[model samples]
Target chain A: MKKIINEPGKFVDEMVQGILLAHPGALRTVGDDLRILARADAPVSGKVGIVTGGGSGHLPLFKGYVGPGLCSAVAIGNVFSSPSSQQVFEATKAVDGGAGVLYLYGNYGGDVLNFDLACDLAELEDIETRTVLGRDDVASQPRERADDRRGVAGIFFAYKAAGAAAERGDSLDEVARIAEDVVVNTATMGIGISPTILPTTGKASFDLPDGEMEIGIGIHGEPGIHRGPLETADQIADRLVGAIIDDLSLADGDRVAVLVNGLGATPLEELYVLYRRVDEVLRGRGVEIERTYVGEYATSLEMAGASVSVLRLDDARLELLNAPAQSPFFREVSA
Target chain B: MRTADLNVVARRALADLVGYADELRDLDQALGDGDLGVTISLGAGAVIEALEQLPEDATAAELAKACAKAFANANPSTMAALVAGGLLAGSKTLVDSTEPNQADAARFVRAAGDNIALRGKTQLGDKTILDAIMPAADALEAGSDPVAALDAAVVGAERAVADTKALQSRRGRASWLQERSIGLQDPGATAFLRLLQCWQAALHAAPAERN
Candidate 1:
């Protein structure tokens, strides 16, 4: 439970306050509640609002993605807990322009419950909204039960694509359709070598021995589908990327975008090592890699692991991916 | 009644509803995490306060939306969220209405019940709040007279609560108890019944009973 902080109870608030102070002109809180953060120039006149929310631990995740060409607003919750429906509604109101709003986030139960309830509140305010869940974690559920899969780092692709559509003033239905299409095309799998200690309880989220690795682990330290002794970086990449590409069913000459993400404790260099193997594997399969991102895009708190996500891309999705995006933790220049 | 009467009656009904919080809490402790009592008490107080601030010219839809926001924000639990969502859904039925009647009450309750059922993913026999809510909705729809409909609602809600004692828990935390939940009173269903009873008493009791 050793970590840097003031009071454990004040961890989320203090961190958020620091972020607001550091990036005053870029991000701002909606209304009086600090839990809801929106782009400074939010409710962008006529663009469809994309509001994403989830727990707090995953930095650069639900919160860091709020900026121009990304999510319009975000409702943050406590570490590993869903935000209240009221918080979600406030974010909805904060980012809702004349065009409708969209709720895009990972597929988690508490999040689903709170956001769905927020939809009702939004309707009462005469604000139309649609929802597209990120269900890209291939290890969480089988293809037959894909809807039941948990969302992981692959949601970044959805955010980028959906945000581009909204930036171009796409209708609410079009934005949601684009987001859902990205979610369906994306596949993610991770391997965990360690676990995280929850800030509130100061307890480990899970237990794993020093030399063992958890295959198909979720960002919240959810148990993986399989566990065994640790393997080399290439071996780990093979397991994760192998599972993802297989799930994606990538064909020869088909194009895909890859994300090699570090789960908290894993270093960037280690991510590159994983990406190198991933590159070889995809190239060997005769699949064309159009775009590659290798870094800490999503992470569990202090968990030692990395995940590989593949988005089977077409020209439209590629163009959307290439569109300009800017956030506190993410940025992309227009092609 | 006009929307003006809606404010006073709703506030009064919620004030009475808070009185049953302890009873609901005790029932929930037997089958759940034992927060239902506080959730109801806090939610009722919040709604009552919110209704107090609404102007005399407030519409029927405004009344329900205010209550929904206040209740949900007061104690942002799963129960609070579902109840607030139900209220918001029910408010849609009154969007065009000013002076709501008995038939309008039925429509609101039915919409609320249906919304809860849809959001909670529970059926009528799930021994949840919806168990009592749906039956009370049916009772409200069956009556033509306002007073009789209120009485019928109380009766229907009570029967649903009683019937829940024979059914295993099937939704929310209570369902985690599995078959062991049988023979115990359901907290959510009982809360709905208590709500109806409170509404009935609010309509019938003297103004001095607001205390």
Candidate 2:
């Protein structure tokens, strides 16, 4: 309930305005309605444009990923709500190069329906569009129904692979293929120690009793698989990483990329603590950690929790993962 | 009713939706992100404004299209988009018809329900708006008079809304709750019922008011 804002209704508008001001050189609003955010150098003639969008509250997600070597544009929506089909269509028009546009986003119903409608509209305008859904949250659904799983922090991998492919002037088909590959190879699981408060409602999205934690919790405060008394940090790490690892069926000598993502309020120190245990567990299983990311890559307002995402990697995915990319929230400085 | 009468009905339906904003928000808070009320209210307000500006001679399809566009522009929520999609699908069925009857209404409802299911990738038992809308469409298709058809539709939707309490969510935000989502009425289904009830009220009131 205690946060800095003038009006709950205008929160998204004010926040987007601030983002534009803060990153004038890198980002700009597209269309008369100003609902789509495109990179300053969008529509880079021959490259396949990459677009992603979702609800607003998850900062540094759809919008933060809009920049060079990442997403070309993002359709902005209200907090925890999908962007309208018209807004998504505007994003498609703003980012369409001759090669076509790739829609990479989570597999939420609203997002899917709206984006699909936008695609139909875009096709009428002679712009080709392809979609790759992210369903990497292992906790949302069982492996047999993986397509029903929610897209969580692991979407970062899809963004990286697809963006890198497009940056290298790959065809739209190749970019979408690479993005889907990342989705298929990645698995994410999270645990929540507390719930986040919705800005407008000024109430917790859900309640978690003090001194307890919920495993397999979704970023939107969706119910998790199990809830019990809080356990040790290592135990929590084991549960999260263990779930992902088991889902991926990773074996010895397998190389992987690790993402220890904080769900907004969790601190870097705590994320590292979880990462240390994750690294130890993976090493014990002889899984090679090719790269690791530890930060708030994806968030749920100020929810206090973290998620562990593991992407089973091959040489192609590893190369894409290491490729140079720059965005306001994420960056991989070429080494 | 003619297209002009449809506009009045549309305006009344939107007003009724705005009135239910708080109730819908409370229902959504139980399992959803708790923004459905505000989002739908904003969409309904925009549609009302659009209805006021619509040309007197606008056709049935034109009116439906305007409502869809207005709703899409005002809010980007899931439920709003689904409603917009339904409107668009329903509008397609009303093309070439200046005056719509009970049969046209039945076709519109059926098309809208089908579009929502196809776009949402959900089925009848998914505990979504389709639960209410699908049965309402079937009831409308079976009835004769427009008012009577709408009455049946409302009854069907009311039953669907009650039935949602026993179902598990398979789509949208509530899907995240898993088994915990049971026992709570699906907010989207409840909203669908409210829309049907509002439309039926407007239809029944129009004749009396005109007389």
Fnat of all models, as shown: 0.50, 0.16
Candidate with top DockQ is 1
**For candidate 2, lDDT tens digit of each residue in A26-97?**
888886555589988988999999989999888878788988889999997888998888788888888888
Restricted to chain B, the TM-score per model reads 0.96, 0.95
Question: TM-score for model 2?
Answer: 0.69
TM-score of chain B of 2: 0.95
Cα lDDT for residue B39, candidate 1:
96
i-RMS for every candidate (Å) is 2.1, 3.9
- Residue A161 deviation, candidate 1, in Å? 0.9
lDDT of each: 0.90, 0.87
The residue-level lDDT of candidate 1 at A314 comes to 96
* Model 2: docking quality category: incorrect
Candidate 1's C-alpha lDDT?
A: 0.90
- TM-score, A chain, model 2: 0.99
Write down the RMSD of all candidates, one decimal each.
3.7, 7.8
